[model samples]
Target: MDNIRHRHITSFQSGYDPVLEPIVFDEKRKTKKPFRISSIKLKNTLAPALATIRNFYNKYYNIIHPLSFTFLSFLTRFYLISLSDVVMWDESHFGKFASHYLNRVFYFDVHPPLGKMMVALAGLLAGYDGSFNFESGTRYPEDLNYTFMRMFMASFGVLMVPLAYFTSIELGFSKHAVILVTLMVLFDTAYLCISRFILLDAMLLFFTFMTIFCMTKFHNQKCDPFSANWWRWLIMTGISIGCVSSVKWIGLFTTALVGLYTIEDLWNKLGDLSIPKIDYLKHWVARIICLIVLPILIYIGCFAIHFAILTHSGPGDSQMSSLFQAGLIGNDFAENPLELAYGSRITLKNTGFGGGLLHSHVEEYPGGSGQQQVTCYHHEDINNDWIVLKPREIEIYDNETDVDVEFVNNGDTIRLLHLGTERNLHSHEVPAPLTRAHWEVSCYGNDTNGDEKDYWVIEAVDDIYKKTNRIRSLSTSIRFRHKVLGCYLRAANIGLPDWGFRQVEVTCDKRNNPKDIFTHWNIERHWNSRLPPGGKANYKSKFLRDFWNLNVAMYNANNALVADPDGFDILTSKPRQWPILEVGLRMCNWASDLIKFYLLGNPAVWWSGTVSLIMFILTLFCYLVRRQRQYNDFSPVQWTYFLYVGRICLIGWLLHYLPFYIMGRVTYLHHYFPALYFSILMAGFLMDHFTASCSLKTKNIIFSIHYALIITIFWYFKDTAYGVYSPNIELRGKKWLNTWDIVD
Candidate 1:
């Protein structure tokens, strides 16, 4: 009765007529008691509980979500890791490299040494003895402990999710967006399958993730520049950059992304008038020391360790400089004579980076001039040896050295007697097997008998030591010019037909380019019994020179991996085909009885990410057009955040991806994995941005649907990556796209 009277008095005071207010209040109180009491009780009961739950989610989602995803990633990544127990895809290549490391035998590969060293370390820790060759499709030996090696590698893949999660948080992603990013990486089928193998791609992907994470962390530290956390993250970013680049040259694309970010950062800082000039100078110095100097040291340090471990000479000895080879434990380069003379038996190595030794075998070319095949070989053999002698027309050849001991001089006409074939190195007007513009070089006539066509004038270009105009072992850069045809002997890295054993074609190039290193030759193995042996000092290799030479060789070798025109590679793919998930690589033998794995990305994740990227471009265009008309849709901070996420994800994807289309090297679907990561991040960004205006309930509903969709798609395709247990016939409808070869 008192409450009703108070409510009536308050209602009358709030501009209702006193009499009407009392009547209305009495009627409402009598008629609405059950409804009003229940409503009040329900509100009182639910509001506090909802607030508590929301507060807990907001406070702990970062911690709980990352931990949850990490646990889930471990399950996804480590499952069935040892299912096949057979060498698959690039495992055959990288595993052999790991063996080379454990055996301490020098081997040359196109990639940098750090990733292989880590693989070797894993093998060493696993008790592997470096005995198995890891041939493709070969079952692992019972004692090899390959499962342990793979588990070690898979650990890197497992951490990628948490790294991406933290990186998104540092980039200021909303809570829901963070979840999306983590899920996309955690459930990607290709990443899951590739990570479970003993391969370098996992390590490469790991360091790439680390670098981006460090970059974002470092970027956030800019507000308090030069703080301890700032310096720590800055140094970490540098270390990550060095490590990623050490895995593979493809890692350089990630480094380039960091570089672009830094450039933009410094440029923005330059425009700030409030920053003191000295402070700005310090900024420059800090970045230079951390980003440039530190990474180079790390890179050089990897090589230094690589050089220390691989002290024994192996098949890769011939790929290095003669001086570098001489330092190897089992190499005979230290025993060779120092000088070149008329009767010296020598191997002529092309001075071009990654070039091979001039060699001739008894086999003749099936087409072109029918003579003993002369080619360039990477390995050392007796067939690579040639005797330097006076031209046949100039003097009668003898089996023994002349008593006068004539030294080979520059511009002297000479005949190269192939020691293994007993034939003279000769070139004629006939076209080469592959390089038709140049004359074919072959071994013609017996050592005791040769014609004027065999005559080659030795042209001294420059010496490596800058000490001599005369020919010398491992130092002089000389060229051989066919005296009769005036063509320069060269190895342009062109391959010959099957009949010529597919060795590098040796041609007498009609075009004489003085700077062409292919035309330059050095005597790598000199053998003159009369001459004294060169001491170790003459064969000393400088680190800088060796480093430069090895990098150039790696570049040349990597560039040579283009698809052979006459061959077809079913496993190969195109850049355009990758983003759409148009194809996948068959990772192992597909026999019905064999447990095979197909490397394909989850279709939902890939297709959605690609669509998001396209939408981002259109959305940005619309926003800019609206802004131009002064229709301010976003606040200044919101606009900056939008551009920041766009630049990082969009620019990163372009950097890692567009280069593949421009690259001449043969590409596979796995090559797009790194770029796909950025696309996933971009998708998360767009999803969060577009839903920002929605009510909290609506947003949760959408996120739940998306999460369920990704999980369902991942489950459906899990067998493809996990391993095809049943026959291929059971997977008929699994192929969502016509281009997917999953069924077969």
Candidate 2:
């Protein structure tokens, strides 16, 4: 078309409907000298060939789609997968998570529980009995049925092709576009490699694509808004939301996409003259129930299942309250519950958003107000215990204060007496163990009782509205606000060296962010309880309270997780570089005998996707301009093409890709998979649009070139993508980029 050299290209190429373009290949173009196929025999032959393609579409389309889908699924299971045997990359993390599910060992992960749960389900179904530890670079156990697990994940990966294909058809894309979408996923080397690994990416992507697929199907039923199939697809979209969201919080990106579309759909419906007000109301309520309420219930159900299965305490226990821990079987808190009163000696434990306990060691600071180092200890020790001491004046007047068995009530201003060093928990002008902006809480001067700086007012958040409420057993979350310095006590979650026992650093900060768990402390072990003899733990009330505490902990932990200067991430990629396929992330390898799995995008898909994106923008701009100049002047296929390819897919891609740039977290190339999916679909749009006007011979040539290139590239990269190779082979003969290292 470009070589034909028209005098001027219109807002859109005229007379090119993707649906009929292949059928009417004999139609003459308005080029400088119209492109001609003067051969009578060739023209005669083309009719039968085109007629055969039309007949296949009209008669055997249904059979072909399913058959093609089956073949792709089988190919995915047979090849791209089942190539690796030993543990690779996140398999170590997720495989252990699966084992924990089998053993009922509760653990923590940044992602939601469903993906890991699915992984566990896959392993269980495959006859794995939670035996393998799945340590990094370690070989999987002999009896482990890894193939079934891999095949299970491969099934989800292959399911994406059909979803995209069917969704494309529903969106009114050309037959070629639908087929191209399937082929795009089939030949994507990175998709093949990542899906094969025992990770959540495969499931995450599957649910995400299904969510989009259902969304397209739902919207495609706009004319039949009251139809059974419409409602079915709508509800299925909501369920898909729950499925995808429960895999990773990043699924929020797709959720947001759906939300915006829902709003737009409703707004458009409301403006429709045919839609009565009552009908619009009915639609609104339906979407609210399906999209909002149903997804919420499903999301909560997944979490409830997560909590139910993980009954025993494991590595994640420290991140939860001791009261919450009491609910778990075979944990210390359940077996040994402690209560407390005034003058009761207790040790405060921080749930590890940032880890450690309220601790003080004998080691002094390097310089300035040198004393026993006050910190948060990660481990248990006798030195961590502190006495609930009254004010300096009350210590001498025992009769006045009754500093004996009287419970330390909420809002009570008390000084902590470090049992090991006998120094008041002081917060003065001295620099803290870490985060120098905060004041130090050091056991200064080695005094039995200290000055005003040492006195801390126990302001129990939400629990301290009254003075009568006492610090009871396994309850009462309070914050120590320094009276003199006027700053809240915090577990900085930063570790200090020898001076602070290399535990989490503790300090008093001027900032009192209510969302932060670092400033909140639960009286883990109070010596006096109101509960009668043989009283059991009230887990229902404790869980409700711990749920709020968990959110706070999650907030702090997620905050701490991002932008950690001490924790350098070599694999992390900037958000901007993702679309261009600039780099690769090395998954794992052992020095002795390496078989590295790098997280890299297929350059062919990534680069072509980028071009398609640019084309989408250019076409959109032209479409908008044309609409403005002559309203209702849209081409036949133009608006329909833009509906799925330009607007929805682009928005989905942007939603997944753009927000990561604002995040301070260490992100990698693998994070781009969701956006990469949209990009592949966008490429489909370009293929359909550009080829719509091409001659039969040119179309054949283009398709053949792409097919050959994809095959050649996939074949060339076979070893790196699938084979677990040794040092002897030359797998880097065509290292496309210097960064693309086939390390095995």
Candidate 3:
């Protein structure tokens, strides 16, 4: 039978009909399994389910990952959002600004008004009455709905993750790269910590993200310029720029990024012969309208709303021009005398930006001749008032003097007698406490016993309207030149030591620069028995002027926030130390019992990002050198993608960060948060570049490993942002870097 079957198989192979041949089965064959799935059967079983899942994913995949990120972000940011019952670092200040808004009281800040307005709106929705002062370390009242306010702020932070994902998608990042971006942002401890509080950082960061997102979104529309989606994204980009800038001046860095992108885009367009002159001109017009005009309008509109809301006088009145203060509901500047005269009791406000009222106290200076301390005070005080007297006056004038009315003229010698101390304003050739080159200004001698050094020759400076020789209260800008030393009296916003009351130092600048606004002064409050009251006629202030003045003042004041050379600021971090995570900020008191939030980034995320930045620079250099050597490492499309994405990320990071190094003001770790975002995107780009050729399985494995590492590190440092409830030994062990002040 075996031989027959073999012959038949051979005959069949030779194309012979072999139906008559008999076949035989081997007796040693194993029995078939009772239950088993065949390959065909398995494929058939899963086909429909797999098809359904694929269809659903294809239909909603765009929303799925971003939504997942958003949910995770909400979990991280909103967890224990109200953990602390006391005020934190910036909340003490920003919360008070918000309260000023709720109370409709005018106030000043170094930053723009929109962020504080948002906090106020949040607090209002949370049923807060704006009664709490939000003093530093003050316990929040039980009735305060602080949680809702925090949640509102955290909402911006939560949206940041989705924004990162979307921005990554717009930048043409691969699916795996996008996932990495979202995960990195979601688990960032600094971003998480800053958002879960009543601060402007979260808002500033959100708008910054929006600006970059809108910019990339608009970039993708270059092929379909002037289309509906293009216009939408263009307008949105402008709005985002405006919103971000309205939050803080730092937002201008992102604005600069967008501006550079636009300039490059237009420059390329300019060289394109395919584009018509008319069409190119339209492009210019569109950018001007949306990017330039629109943002300016939005920024001005925010100030309009701010001014409209804060109609009552408050602590910020002194920061504005007297005319602006007179417009407030509860200010007495409108009732003051119009003309300055001898024997008038007045407060001389420094005309410099962020300047204060000319003030003196009975306390003597610990250094610098030990005379009565003359300083610039921000708030109203009896010590701020001075009695205007004749140069030869030997006696202090009474409150109601019978002296004849004599209007002050330019270059007239006069005496300023401190009403509270009865001492004449005197300056000698002694170094000021803070400014060594300037002479020490102090209140010396009784009002009846001042010498020639007490004489100040008041000279009229340029007024807002025009030149003026005769001094008018609240309208004239005047400078006092010391008769003996010839130094102009100045207040450069330099603060004195504790013994000098921490008020701004009033010095007589030795330099004879006539244009020094720091030496300028104006009478804010004028009282005389002879002169008539000044009405609201000349006291009217234009919004544009006030806006410009306030912004300049803010700029000056912000720059004045330099770290004291004699003192160490533990919370301050240098710009160079920020990217490397060399230091962390203590966001609150670090007592064992109080819940603490430390502003430190996740090590895996921050260090990885820093490495990626260096790698990107090195890789770009190598690529350029290789290309110059006739090596074609990338195709045209691939090269374009590489350079485009690389430039945006690299330049964005530099633009946001490099300025901090040049800035005179003190910086903190949080200042680096905006720039960290750009670095994170660059990291995602680098990840994409490395994994572009990897198989799906390999890519999945790499992504999974990264995800695990990020999550683990975030978990280890989670207590930093989520609030450390109590001191623990385990917490100290988590401090991988010695520079990190993670524990007491």
Best prediction by lDDT: 3
TM-score result, candidate 1: 0.89
The clash tally of candidate 3 reads 0
RMSD of each: 9.4, 11.9, 8.9
Residue 404 in model 3: lDDT: 62
TM-score for each model: 0.89, 0.84, 0.88
- Candidates by TM-score, descending order: 1, 3, 2
lDDT (C-alpha) at residue 217 in model 1: 95
Instruction: Give me the runs in candidate 3 sitting further than 4 Å from their true place.
Output: 1-43, 363-373, 393-404, 427-453, 464-469, 482-487, 497-499, 509-514, 564-568
What is the alpha-carbon lDDT of model 1 when measured against the actual structure?
0.88
Per-residue error at 176 for model 3, in Å?
Answer: 1.3
TM-score of 2: 0.84
Flag regions of model 1 displaced more than 4 Å: 1-58, 362-373, 393-404, 428-437, 447-451, 462-466, 484-486, 510-513, 535-537
Best by TM-score: 1
Rank the models by lDDT, top first.
3, 1, 2
Model 2: lDDT equals: 0.74
